[model samples]
Target: MNGRISLRGLRAKGHHGVYDFERADGQDFVVDVVLELDLSRAAVSDDVADTVHYGELATALVGVLTGEPVNLIETLADRLLTVCLADERVETAEVTVHKPQAPIPHDFADVAVTLRRSRL
Candidate 1:
């Protein structure tokens, strides 16, 4: 359960925000995901089937990132976590959604939401 797999700086376009312009034109959303799971089986067998595949995981996460438009990054992060935890092998999932081009007028390096969930 302590073993971790992470994907960082995943960029996708999504129409997600409270602003009408945001939903109309869309903006870039960046995501980072960390999945916790047991890797012993894969280590012992050297078989991919025993572990989570990074390529497939990326595609799935991207699907969630671009699939629907939500009003909040919190909602997007929650959905992204769901995608990460869909694999039974994952015991815990941590997701961060970055909205770099957020509607704020002030100068900011980044705006993000981080959420973590553990399997029941």
Candidate 2:
């Protein structure tokens, strides 16, 4: 009964960077999460209570993105991972934070940090 839930492209404006201007100006952060858990109860009961409510999880994650100031996308990714693991049902979680507006001299498509955690 193991199941996986994926959430992608959760965006929010965040003041997070090593540079003062970058923090002050803020930038959009995109998050993608994969949650692993048992889905047997939810599958049989047909109730959201039996599984992680992704909509609610998204709101909480956005709050984290917009609420705090961090110096690295790695930290942001860790914070997002923490949120994903808040649900006891989640046995493992993977979070990826994309910083599309990263301050780089050369042309780059994106900069991102991906973190994975498990409760064992």
| Top TM-score hit | 2
Per-residue CA lDDT of model 2 for 1-120, tens digit only, reads 999999999999999999999889999999999999999999999999999999999999999999889999999999989999999999999999999999999999989899999999
Please give, for residues 34-90, the per-residue lDDT of candidate 1 as tens digits.
Answer: 988999899889989999998999999888878889999999999999889889989
The TM-score that candidate 2 achieves is 0.98
Best by lDDT: 2
Indicate the worst ten consecutive residues by lDDT in candidate 2: 67-76
| Cα lDDT, all candidates | 0.92, 0.95
Q: Model 2, which residues run further than 4 Å from truth?
A: none
What is the Cα-based TM-score of model 1? 0.96
**lDDT, model 1, position 86:** 88
- How much is 96 displaced in model 2, in angstroms? 0.2
lDDT of 1 at 20: 97
